[model samples]
Target: MQGHTPTPVFSVRDKRNLLFIILGLVPAAALAFWLHILPVFQGLYLSLFRWSGLSPKRKFVGLANFRALANDSLVWKALGHDVYMVVFRLTAVIVLALLFAGILHFSSRRKQKIVQGLFFFPNVLSVAVVGIIFTFIYNPSIGALNAILTNLGLENLTQAWLGNPKTAFPAVLFPTVWGAVGYQMLLLFAGMSSIPKAYTEVALLEGATRIQEFFQVTLPLLRNVVKTCVSLVVINTLNRTFIFIRVMTKGGPNDATEVLGNYMFYQGFENFKFGYATSIAVINFTLALVLTFVVTRLLKKENLEYA
Candidate 1:
């Protein structure tokens, strides 16, 4: 009798609920595969060949393209530039956005709204337009940047920002970081806004300075948000680097600004090396996947008690 308590069983209602859940997931899973997973497989398959744009023969070279890519010095150089961008862009966006978000989050509602909109305005425009505008802004002759520098008696600092190999990479990256700040700031600000007001009040009651409260209380609570922002920045920079480089520098200034995206385009379309280009795509996708996984593991959240 003591052992007679029957194990809980899935009732008819429970089974019906499970059935509905499975039904709902079917289309979503199918869509994900069709849209995202299928393309990756297709690209990987295409990368193993030696096909020009017109060739129906589809000569299978079997990893030759990847082998060539390994030996390609230009590819390595482009990758090095991308790695540099990852560090610089993340640093500029995160630090600047965090500082501005703190300012806005603590400001009055009207002031915060006006300034936040101004900050995020750049994101609403097409990237091409922003690039075009900045191209003019960086123009050495009549550009606003040089004009301001000249007027400030820093004429020595004014140079061909986009044409000089030493300055071209940073020139291209500056626009990216500038446009990204608003979005990242807004994201971090939202996370800050969500922090329980009681926590701040308690910290203040304990005679903590504003800086102490921020470091100990606000930032700790926003750890997950910061991680998410970093991940998004990584993804956005990787994808958008092609467009920025193409429109602004076209990987010029002696290829100082070459990155994966534009370089892949040049190989596939301009050079008509489709197979080689797809190999580059495979590398790009793999690099992105690996970085995202590592970042997720590194930023893994703990069971912090928050009420």
Candidate 2:
């Protein structure tokens, strides 16, 4: 047999293009490493030790924190709340956003602009402001919700929305959905708009009903956008629930509204269990990664392009 030289894996032009693409991504990659990737690794390292956040004394008790997490009842409770929040918030927000987006897509331009502005206005407000507003609305006495109920002769239907243990978790979710719906709606609307009109026209011409057209045509084409929205919601549900829990309920009524983020903060900052807190953080990050992967996989499909 004669010896042969190996062929290049990439052509010269392909190599050049790869280099340019990498150079273009350098800033983003650097930023993501610094802000996201580095912190995750740091957290993993810290989870294996015992230390208060500020103390000089550090002890390596490998896997001890994770063991503690396994036995902690609060961890399971908070995780349950997180699951509930993710399921309900994801469903409500996506459904409402899609509904409004469909309506907006079909409306006149003037009506579309007005409805979009109204829907998206809540996103302009800070989370703290929205939480506070909801808190006042849910107050046991003199809350807008109660007042409305009383005026409508439904006084018996009124109760402390954020105060009662039974209602606190669900109550916290409403504001989150309210604030999120507009942004998601706009995203879906843009997806809808980018779809060529010819597709809808063809569907209609083929005797497809509007509902059938939406299910078979519009939604299938919007898969990528919907996937992005789903991924965003999952990440936010894991990471961003802290502010809502802190401001709205503070995981109150005997930790009834507790989520992983809230409990992690309580452990690290309030109780100074940095190692244990980081363990919770590790769990959170893992769950987020897994959920994102699931969403991406579920929504994976061939890209549809308009001619």
Candidate 3:
């Protein structure tokens, strides 16, 4: 009988606390929706119409813009450039970063910190700044690269790096790798540091050489970290538009180095075709998302038990 007393449902204090929590979050939620979500929706809507962005008129064309993009040769070419970026820039960044991280990880503590700091310095600068610096470095007449080649008697190798279509994409790719390597190095270094010293020590005791230990122990354990780094690099390489377009070549020499980002920018801003640009943006976003998901899933299958 005493246990039969019913507990009160819906306590007044609990309800008041819930109400206060909702009220407190309302402003932040509103701001996010207005600034981010609303704009995304607006962009999607705009993609369904034909608009010049500045004109006073907009004509609804349904999926025609997307269809047009599918047939646009330039879009495919830009996408190919994006693929090249992933292959060259992203791959170089990951390789150099991991190599540097490995070297720093095996060094003394003091040396490790110094090397880490030096490697990560490039990441501190804005992308635009990095582009500008590299632009000067690749300048045909006075750039450091050309200057070095000239001094080394490799004059035949020296040309207007950014001006020639043959070298323009690779020229931009080098700077992208230089700017990005530092950040990825730091991430890999942190991951490597988290690995227990006992594993390597045991490997050494078993008469395993340092190279053998790296492949047998360190790399296997760092698989997850490698996956994360790869995903990030891919996304960055795909989404990056401004730095390449702004610094070296703006899809110059007959759209040779044009990537999706630059293509979208040209369509929307330069050509004033808002609808077409929105379609490109949507496609680019979709590509990035798909690549991220696919790579993450593939890596997850080979995930190592770091713990």
lDDT of each residue in 31-114, candidate 3, tens digit only: 999997999989888989899989899999999999999899999998878777777865698889889988888899999888
Per-residue lDDT over 1-307 for candidate 1, one digit per residue giving the tens place of the 0 to 100 score: 4656534453335677678768988989999999989987888999999999686788999999999999999899888887788778888999999999888867999999998999999888888988998899999988999999999999999998999999999999898887889999999999999889999889989999888888889988888898899899888877776698899999998989998888899999999999999998888777777776776677776844576
For lDDT, candidate 2 versus 3, the one ahead is: 2
RMSD of each: 5.1, 5.6, 4.2
Candidate 1's C-alpha runs over 4 A off are 1-37, 301-307
Per-prediction TM-score to the true structure, in the order listed? 0.87, 0.87, 0.90
> Which candidate number has the best TM-score?
3
* Predicted structure 3, TM vs. truth: 0.90
Q: What RMSD value applies to candidate 3?
A: 4.2
Q: CA lDDT of 167 in candidate 1?
A: 93
Query: Can you give the lDDT of residue 272 in candidate 2?
Result: 96
Alpha-carbon shift of residue 9 in model 1 (angstroms): 26
